[model samples]
Target: MAVQEMKLREKSAPARVRVVVEEAAPPMMPVIYRRLSAESLRQALRKMLLIRRFEESAEDAYMRGLVHGTMHLSIGQEASAVGICAALDPTDYMTSTHRGHGHCIAKGAQVSRMFAEFFGKEDGYCRGRGGSMHIADVSTGNLGANGIVGGGIPIAVGVALSMKRQKRSSVVVSFFGDGANNEGAFHEALNMASIWKLPVIFVCENNGYGMSTSSDRSTAVKDVAQRASAYAMAGRIVDGNDFAEVAQAAFDAVERARQGGGPSLIESKTYRIRGHSRSDRNRYRTKEEIEAWLARDPIGAFERQLLRLGFITTADIDAIRADVEREIEEAIAFAKASPAPSIEELTRYVYSD
Candidate 1:
């Protein structure tokens, strides 16, 4: 009876103690600002703010029926554009996606001309022939922003080829979305770039969704950087929200390409705070998901970092904001005052022959 009682007591005792496995802390990213000058940091902040304000204003213009046709805004993905472009030399070339205003702005295109182009004015790039999705500034090495998904990949490869043939030291950077990775052009361009060892950097802005479809449903690979393996090139994943991280990856990739190390792929995991287009109601995502991303706003986070690092003060930030606001307002005024393209010049730029 005593033995039976002891057996029962043992059975009633708690099972083996459970041990929780703690996850390791992520490694620290390099301090990019330490290597950059104060002027560079200020410029980055200014450019990022300018892109945000410009996008906000553009949205308002679209709603007011001032901008015609469809428009894609990179409101939340400014860090990826600015960070990567800032890592490049002034003479380096870059191709942008439909959501490319930020890329143009980061690469030093005049805001007045960008607004003028949207307004369809004669003084605008492309003389108002190209709308929001087609802005290009050859003088600044901005090849142009493509409307078709994955359209700019091959164009960037072609530019790289031209540079290679000319024996130029310049490199080309191609920016595209997660959706573009599924396209055939992406595969073709990467393959050719690989075989020829073209001086190009293929940047994939994996913003979680391609239109309304989540990347989880569309892409087979969890990380777009894995695609580089198929091409036998180097690839990396970066925190697109962290400007320092993106800039570091871009710097390494740009340096590699410049040194004839061939092409590299960088997948920047980011999110779009705004809808895919003006007409989108964003019903596909939940408020909770959006709020989570909003908490990680690149501009706000960077501002805090700058303050904490003593790189800038609240007053400095405010001054930068005021300056950017004034500049954007002047750009809008210039666009408003500029005249539309003349009817006689309609067919002038239509044909190559």
Candidate 2:
């Protein structure tokens, strides 16, 4: 446990410590969240690390010919996924983007099952019907990962609508990139959610680019949060790479929605560490830009935060990384021995009775 730790650098005072456990819990804008217990913090960090390792291994598996279809990596975007996930209860639903492995892990989906699903095995969560792009664990309140841009946004709004109509307190969150913000569905969903005062939070992970296009090149407005005002909802612009800040902001919005305060838009200004997909040459972005974001890597940043806050020992972190790597390796093994879904079963799940 003897390890030199890092310190928590304050970018801004965090919103207050009002964390609601259920969908109906009240909301508050705390300056900063009440410091989570070491166990709580550790669990969140472990999940994030697990996500990082799982994604890295998945990428390797795809390269090794074990997993088919497109695979998205959430390597550098761990905190944005994990921290917000920490703010919610298991009953709260979530919708994920194409690069949604981090969301899967953070939302408590089983790693082995996810891998099996990706490998198209019968034991997989979706029974091999949904592959990398369509992973879902209903037990964890994950609706599913949508392949289409802005596709899940409307779905999340529907879930929130259902929650309100049924007198359910659960809030639903939709995680997407800035590219999704420009979609017509995004505007439509936001308008409805605002009008209905639906318990939904639109989480925009502005990772600088949509596929290969940079944000500035594609987006006319500098801030996606600015769009929130059009809907008359709260707009929170935050550093997505900062785990604490992201978690705090999300907690506030989710709580607000739970208590009938309505929807909020959180623009998490972060970056992607990998190319848009496995085959991306990354020619659209400069090497220096990637390097700059890497310098502030979310995983490394959080690890340092734990160390500085004396929340975790070097031994603890080492154990965490080692365990994550081991779990990922196990997932790969499970995936390798698995068989692909049969060609004869293509018509199943295409329609529900």
Candidate 3:
């Protein structure tokens, strides 16, 4: 009976064995798309649009003598501002540079109040005391915009240390320019932040030229992010014009910091299409250079990306533009209608109450 069973088994095609292999899982989504919703992305685009339009309107207002004092217009670097801020929670804190109107708007400041600040009205974020360079909205977690280069870096370090002491899960972002990278404060702040493992993100908005002195002419290192090694921290560089790229880098750094992984140095390679300040004649650069940067406009690049991704249509862009225009008009009207800080109380906000 055993011999007969063996012969029967052998006759059944030798009992062939099959091996199964599973295919690899589909690639994970891009960081921005994975972490942020479609609505968040749309709001990002809207914020970028808001920054661009607001800057243009502010320039017009400045030209028409409606605004006083020189203002640093961020004209072409909207993506760097809005993209980085998109990764932040409303509770997270940030400090800005002189070129910070974009930062203010990206952090959820009302354009009407921003315009009011620009107009030096009483309803402004600083109650007209800060003006264009000193806009601060503590309620929105914006520490303030620093007129001094690299000034915010140390401030951010202190804030981060405070958060650590209190055991808060918040992080502080210090937004500076390429010019600030050379400052002594920057190195000291980075070193301290790294040693203490503080949650601070040092964002260098390297817009090629630091007030007409090209970074190539000023910075010893090819890229500012390379400086991270000195402080033993993570360093990354992204095309500051590409909103998606900027958002991804910022999100990764933010997450790392929030999780107690320490600080990061992100160098955003962007260009400012406008002169450094209102008084700049732009003679330090050429028309061709300006045109090249303008062609690579951050807002336009982001808009194109949104349209291609089906996040927004041309009509959506048009409607957003219209909505922003109305908002700007309304902001200007509000500023014009708002009262100015009284002369008798000129020192009202000078000291902490």
Candidate 4:
């Protein structure tokens, strides 16, 4: 990292308060683009930093015996969730999976409350009712994170259906992993979305493996995007590690959906550096595979691209890192300081909060 990038990470959150004065917007790419101005690039980079910091923090806490349950970190694949989310409006809906921390942050979820929920506090998104696998912020249009793989796809279809019925212009983005493509629910949901021409962008994040099983062994399709043809929808494969590609793909899909062009599938070919879960030994794959993916670290790659393009200084990235670290620390403090839901409060929301 350059000196300027270092400074950027150090002053992360404080810089966000300033207004971005855009003299002229950069050219938009229908397929892929990383041509963001310095300020916009900084903001996007900060979000990726935030997600990386947040998940790593949660993992550290889990190891230290702070978090009580399972925690799936979305550390390596931050670009897939964050960049796509940047293309969305607050009114648009998205459904998440077990590895949902990145999704939550991308959907504008409150970081402090998310931490509170992780700590089982009363102020959590689910008010402490839902734990790690069930975080939900309805206000942000993040339908609760599903515990079951591929479970949220159909639900997102339904959400999109409602948007269609109401003519709301809002589209539902359904994010599932490569593992989900093998599931029956994924196929069923795609079928329905295809038949109805519902505005749903099915983003299959092909992170190479489905738990312990390699996607190569799990499915015959070279790319999950090819399956969209069977569903009668347009499909495209993208470099998921590239934020520009991700943002462009999402923007194209979102605009098409808004224009009532129905569903599309985007296969974001990326990798998850961590194990399937916190407990994963990660020995199922070879060291070379891990090292290869690490070489293409999405956040680091984007940061380099931004710097080379003169869009970000090293100071910007460093300031972002520090602010993200502090934010995570503050979240930890908030979660620890907040009270656990009272036994009395448990029955409260069950009836009426």
Per-residue lDDT over 127-226 for candidate 4, one digit per residue giving the tens place of the 0 to 100 score: 7778789988889889978889999999999999999999898999999999999999999999999999999999988888889999899999888999
TM-scores for every candidate against the unseen true structure: 0.91, 0.89, 0.90, 0.89
The 10-residue segment of model 1 with minimum total lDDT is: 1-10
lDDT of each: 0.86, 0.82, 0.85, 0.83
Error of 2 at 173 (Å): 0.4
Better of 1 and 3 by lDDT: 1
Candidate 3 deviant stretches above 4 angstroms = 1-30
| Candidate 1 lDDT tens digits, 274-303 | 889878999999988886676667777676
- Which model scores highest in lDDT? 1
lDDT of 4 at 193: 98
lDDT of 2 by residue, 218-301 (tens): 887889999999999999998988788999999899889988999999999988888888788988988777766766677666
Instruction: Find the number of clashing residue pairs for candidate 4.
Output: 26
**Lowest lDDT 10-residue stretch of candidate 2:** 15-24
Candidate 1: stretches off by over 4 Å: 1-29
Summed backbone clashes in each candidate are: 0, 10, 0, 26
Instruction: Name the regions of candidate 2 deviating beyond 4 angstroms.
Output: 1-35, 342-344
**Model 3: clashing residue pairs?**
none
RMSD of 4: 6.0
